[model samples]
Target: MPDSQIKFLVVDDIRENMVALEALLRRDGLQIDFAGSAAEALELMLVNDYALAFLDVQMPETDGYELAELMRGAERTRNIPIIFVTAADRDERRHFRGYEAGAVDYIFKPLDPVVLRSKAAVFFRIGQQARELECQRDEMRVLAHHRDIAISRLKAHADNSPLALIECDRNLTLRSWSKGAERMFGRSAEAMLGQRIAQSGWLDAEAAGILQTWVDGGTSAQRHSAEIDARRADGQTISCEVFGSTLCDLNDGNLSLSLQLLDVTERRRAEEVRSLLIGELNHRIKNTLANVQAIARQTLRQADSLAGFEQGFVGRLQALARTHSILSDMTWSSASLDQLIDEQIRAGTLDAARLLRKGPTVQLTPENALRLALSLHELGTNAAKYGALSVPGGEIRLTWTYNDELLVLRWEERGGPEVHPPARTGFGTTLIRASAGCEDDGVSVDWSASGVIWTITLSVGVAQPNQPDQERLIEPAKIESGRPELDGSRVLVIEDEPLVALDIRYELTAAGAGKVDIARSIGQALEAIRAAEIDVALLDGNLSGERVDEVANALRGRKIPFCFVSGYGRQHLPQGFQDAPIIEKPFRADALLPVIHELIRR
Candidate 1:
């Protein structure tokens, strides 16, 4: 074979070995150089590039490892493939060390001529391919840089042009607007971008409605034009032809919306002046709606009682009012979900632990928030009147989270009067499921007489990620009945309910209590405990005559062990005393036995 392309370096203490390696590789079209030691190899490499280096493992002053490390440290020869020529057994540690020091492969001292030639040829082709790829990458980088510069220039020209250009995302948040938009909208470009066009005063109600008509399923990627009025930053309204189109980039496949404002002030002002009569017609229509509601309310009020009216007109009016209020608060744009929940549930007074409100923490755009709040208000009003929060012995907990892009909120009731699910769907239910003006499905309210649980999910664009728990607001764990076992100890029962007092006496007798006393009022209970040797007292909260908390204080003063029995919930109890034994009303006999025993056992 002609020695035309490949290059190789041979290093060894013996000149005869270099000659033999060079002769063997010459058959593969390789040019060979000789170095008698590592120092000579370093000198040759500094001046030229070699495809492969054959280093003798047993050099005198600096071995193959030392020489390979030197070549690897030099930038030019760092990646040159090294082959360690050695007679040492492959299992020897130093022979392995030679490979670790950057040797590509190992060759015994009596090198096989064919094996040497093949290895050198392998590295030469690899090096040539690597150089080619590096050149291609550099070219791609140059092309990308030029593309970015072209895009930047195009955007700058678009911004400086006279026509107002507005770009918005799917949710209608302005993503980009040009200098012309800033001038026409009476706002800075920086202030307008990322703001909703409606909020930035770029389009009036009529113009926005027309634009929305185009935005919803108009010919995809086609321009739409209509004449309407837009508002400027100075609060001055101008006549304009609003042009809108869906933008689909063919190369990148990104979907966007583009809106353009062509000032038709002189051409359209005459038309708008003539259309002032149309604005009056719209106002009349709104007045007609209010008049209809008023008439409905007046007709419903003719009934003898308010219940019929509440179901018919009042509920509808409240829903409408809530919607209006929410719209006003959001400036008719969007409402925050958290703010709506806070407003509707403001009346619930359960302890932080008992009342929990958790969710995605994203603000609902005005329309969704308004509809959801109206539904939740109905749920809230019903709970305030008859559900868990209505009675003293109840609790309501609300929590929500976003799972898989779906928003779900849950209301759980506990420690409440026996619940029976709502017998029939009422106005509250209808308002919840009403899909009148919202993109989301209607509210879902699950009403149990025990309490009302409601979940409202509306797609309000993209949902937010789950937030970490703000603070653990869970109810403290109930203190297990610390009541000692009665163990024949004297027990006192102070209760206002005659039947309940008699029942406690019966329970204590069954439990083998030595003595039992029942008191209907705090005064009587106080006297009985003072006069008797009472080991344990089962006190009833809400005595006919006094506060049960005061009775507890007196019992504690007397060093008497006492547990409370009441229909009241944790919410009704005074703060800082949740740990006390509180047996819920209508508890079973077996439950009472444990408390009686546990309290007196001590």
Candidate 2:
């Protein structure tokens, strides 16, 4: 309520005295209630909250001291300030009695208006301050009520959440555990609370140390998150993503820790599987591209014209692509040898019905599948162009049998133009002979007057069941006379993917680069730049979500040339780096070597 609404009481038997008291206390915003007798004053005091009271000491029936005593006895009026007014002369004994009766001051009349007003003003201000204190107290109570409700709601939510919530003290002693924690850890709050986190044997030493550091630092605002292994009640280790933050205890204002743990065992396992698959994919892609490169080089070496080279290269790539598709459909594990032969024959011949094929159910590994598919494609192409399939009634009999774990396959042609062995070795011939193990006398070609008979006997080990064996046909080229030479030059490679980074390191090392340094992120790259004297740098455009601009700037400041290698386009590069050479991903040795040589020369 507004201060102006505050009321004061005045009691006296004489009308003149009551008027005098009211007038003396009168001021703007001052409310006065007049009562002539003690009984009447009691009634007014009961109904209205009075700031101060004036009682006449000599009233009939009940005197000022008696009325003051009555007001003091009541709960509501006990705290109200009282001043006694009397016409009789002041005596020490009467003053003591007045004070004993709860009178704050005794006034002897005829009263001095100045002294009375001064004392009344003092009481008025005191009453206003008291009311304000009461109002503030009420507001505090309301705010505290709301805070309690909010805390209760949060506790309810935390209890029901899937993430475990655990609160610990500075000593890493568990203080509170949510229901979610109990469910996640398979331990009850009663069992875990007040136990040292380390003693519980759930968190590993490293994880425990991390939590200890956070607690020791008293970093309430800073959040720390990490993936760690935590042992459950059943002693099974599970992967958990833990988020730690500091919280202040409302009761004691002491620093404590709140840890939220999310069980990510499945997620971590899935990520491991995905990473393995990605590594496998990278290896496969590298191998496939290398194969394509070899095919192009070999095809180009024997092509009579550019058109011939294009035709041969495209046909080889198509054959590789089709084989890849089939392997992909089978999850890259194994493919049916008979199915592979049929598909290749159908692709090359419109009269596929005329072709004879016989084979047992045989599954070929990815490596063997790809190589065998290419060989079969080459054979079919040859038959269609110059051998049996060139004539309408021509017949190509392909048969295979497995004995003593050896696969014997024969491609015999008949009823077509006379055939002769090629005058010069071609890519098709090389691929077929190499794949069939002709170097080991595993394959033979006999040119007869009727047709060409090519027979191959390979151990079943050549067609590995599920595992893709390393190719024996081609090996990655190393630094040679024609390749770019870095003999004594230092090179820095910045890439996040481990496999890609390793590949870059291998390539640089093979090119005779000395002291090749690899950094998986921008921070590491910057550190490497500071420590090493780099001649040239190959930086992935994105390093773990951070752009390599800072590293690039550092390299530029050092007058060291750097190139960007990324799966993204040049447009995705940071501004000012567009001028830098960008080699798109899946780059070959020929493409990468030239860039490196140019950068080193610059």
Candidate 3:
């Protein structure tokens, strides 16, 4: 029934009695139904709810007591309040029988309206309160269902999160481990729960100690953020950035640490790589600066005036710049040999008819390409000044060949002025020999009567640090007559970096050294020491990736004077040459030549 309606049922064998009671008890919000017989009342009771039922005690086929017995027996109608109505005197035995049949009270036939309304009002209020309670119970059930769904979603989100999430109790025992944590640490939740975090073998001893210190240094609610070195199950080192906060559980106000760990190992490694690349770039730049310095000095030496100096220096610088541009296009990796030749020809403005290029395909390493480009520029400068290019209808031929293990290149001038060796070796000849590596027979120049011919043999393939291309041909020039420091002296320049070696060779040649040999590796330096009488040597403390200690030891054994030319500190040099003369790189010819002069004098 509606909450605003209070229903009451009244039954009698006489219609007048029921009608009189309904008229007496009826009011707003109260609904009264009249039934003529006990059977009609029983049928009405089964289908509709009633706050109170009033039945006559005396009836033809059934009495109020009998109807009450039936309502008491039924589960659906048993709880309806019953009030027996009769037109007889009160008796103890009758009252007992009415009470036994589930009657709350009995009303006489000429009913009092005041007493009836008071009794009925109590039951009506009780029924309304029951309906209110039922509605509240249903609302509570819906709220509980919604709460369960929210908890399920929150749990799923935590478990599937990409960052590792872990919760631990006040005692540092793991209480919750998400699937993300499990995957990151390679440990299952079953194994981790109840395990003390610091002792769980997840963090290294030092990291665990640091964390413990953090916890003990502050209150339970303190937050922590730091990057820590962690370890996987396989014992490999990993880096993680940890963010931690102490959370108080709402239910019991219990404190626990919640941590989110982010993996940063790869990012850390990339930073290290960037640092190394920057260092290497700094080293290469230093080498280039040294080359420029060498060029300026040598150009000054050969120039007849300021104009000649500017022309020569700027041309060499531009050639260096052009070579760098070409290498930069390939990311400084390698350059095509023929492509380099063609570029140099175009840059030098060489006559296409007078010069022939015949070469198989070859790739030169970045350093080799640059060195050869500058060397070729020097050759062109000389040829234009005195060789084939100086005369009309003069001709030049260039060719190259490779035999898988070695590469050879040749430069020949067929028609020009009668070729003859100069009294003193020029910078061009010195650079060609210096950059050609220190191997014996690596480079040679033949001054034929007709013109000049140059041949360069380079070892290529696997063992070389980078691709091959070295050596050059130019005007024949022997050592210049000079002061006693280096007249007719034979020297060894043991260095790995080609550009630095080239500068050293130029300096040595200008100092009147008759022959300056170059060695780029340990074995090559050792072989050079054993192959010829090296009056003095310049030994790089480190050649390629190895210490050139063997070369130093050989020089010491031969009683040949040599100095350590390196960028390393004295402490980093090889064993037992502490007293040897040393010159750091980015060194000048003025600073370097005196040391060799002293070594030769000694």
Candidate 4:
């Protein structure tokens, strides 16, 4: 109803007093109704709703108090606000009696017009608000009725649809089954109804238990979906996708579930085949790229002329091929560290009596196997050229120990020509130092007069007997100029090549990124992005064959600044990422550090 139609009732035996009261409460949106006596006021109240009532204290036969008592006794007028209008002097007892008669307030004789009108206006606005709330409740009831109709229509449709539909009670007993369900499961409703769904042989024990758990734990609003192997009446298993939801039975108000099943055995089989093929392809491509990189590095290092480059390149390729052969035998999972050292160092050596090796059994991951194989090759080549192996009487001892989560290797040479530090570090020296491990001061070389003694320390994650509980060793601190301290910033590196990933992690830590996370696949990268509190990210433009655009977009959406570290150039990137900085592959610390600092500052 419109606000303009609201009514106010006035009661008094004196006609003049009623007129004065009506005029006092007069307003544009108010409908004022007057009654000459208590009986007349009660009659009008029986048929109409009032925002408020003004009742005189004195009356002919039935006083205002008596009329109010009758109104209170009935449900219809009990909550109507009453204001007592009186000519009597202000007496405490009379006021108390007025309250007992359900007067919400009182107005004295010769009432102040301003006070009376203001108080009545307050009740009028409150009545309007109450009416609006009631209207809203009515609209909601209508919507609920329509929703019930829709559910009924859905039930009818399910009975005739091709997909199987079954309903079960709270205890998982079959309450209803459609014709589609009977055909799909090869059982009639008469045989299944009122029996536990598990007894019907439609679902195996494990599948049934999983469904039951969801039903018992889930609320009426939750809809759960699962793929399970279901058994039919003939004892044949088929993969099916089940959609289940909890609902209330309208007739009994008991909890029940509605389940729909669709066959998907063929689709699942096809997807598995496709996933296996893709995984194998990505593995082969990445391995081939790593081999090419290794060959290029060695070729450039040993090449003084075209002939020298060809000869060195072929030797390095053969060495890399041998390592790959061993890795392939192990399905590229891991290789024994001792086997790797022997294969790489003792390949073409005739005087093997000069070399001594000692170490416990340790397995190296495929990436580590390749890197260490190259480093050992470089060290052996140097020794053959200028160090111990070049002399017939020279001797070299390789001893290693694992303790406190640190793997320490000492390469000591004696009985050779006097040694001195090189004027400039060569690529072989750099590769050996990096592979052996260098954090602050992990790699050290003693250029004694007798020979060179190299001590290298690496942090190993796997635990062994007598090893320290800590998974990593504490690194010594180093202060480097032009490298800003990240002050414990969290960094995420998304690279698929394991060696490159390790390099990025090491550099990030050395530059003061307290936490460095590695993600080798797109799925793992996305998971890390969500789970970590990342301050900056170093993203590889591509992960295997998939581009890192999705990860970059997610970082952008979160306002996390990141730069791409890829082999590709700017034009090769996706359209929207042209402006994002791209740190080219074979990253240098000088180029990478500034970009990282700028990203964090921005």
Most accurate candidate by TM-score: 3
- Per-residue lDDT tens digits of candidate 2, residues 1-602? 35446688999999998888887888876789999899999998888888899888898999888999999899988988888988874788988998998988988898899999999888888877877888999999999999999999999999899999998998899988889988888889998888898888878788999988887777645898888888889998888999999877779878888899999999989999999999999999899889989999999999999978876776777677767767767888788776576556534432456577666666777777787788887887888889888888898888877766788779899998988777887889878776654347877889887998888777754442443322111122232226788777898888899998788788788888887888997788888888888889998989878877788899888888989988665657777866588766655555577788888988
Q: What is the lDDT of candidate 2?
A: 0.81
Candidate 1 global TM-score = 0.37
How many residue pairs collide in each prediction? 17, 0, 2, 0
Q: Say which prediction, candidate 2 or candidate 3, comes out ahead on lDDT.
A: 2
Q: Which pairs, if any, clash in model 2?
A: none
Candidate 3, overall lDDT? 0.79
Candidate 1 at residue 64, lDDT?
Answer: 85
Ranking by lDDT: 2, 3, 4, 1
Q: Please, what is the whole-model Cα lDDT of each candidate in the order they appear?
A: 0.68, 0.81, 0.79, 0.77
Candidate 4 displacement at residue 297 in angstroms:
4.9
For model 3, how does the per-residue alpha-carbon lDDT over 286-390 read when each residue is reduced to its tens digit? Answer: 999999999899878977899788667766776677677677667777877765666566554355657776756677877777777776777777888899999
TM-score of 4: 0.36
Alpha-carbon TM-score of each model against the true structure = 0.37, 0.56, 0.59, 0.36
Model 4 bad stretches (over 4 Å): 1-277, 280-284, 287-291, 294-298, 349-351, 437-440, 461-602
CA RMSD per model (angstroms) = 27.1, 14.0, 20.4, 23.7
lDDT of 1 at 148: 95
Which digits, one per residue and each the tens of the lDDT, describe model 4 over residues 329-384?
77777776566666654354213567777766566666666766666676777777
C-alpha RMSD in Å of predicted model 1 compared with the true structure: 27.1
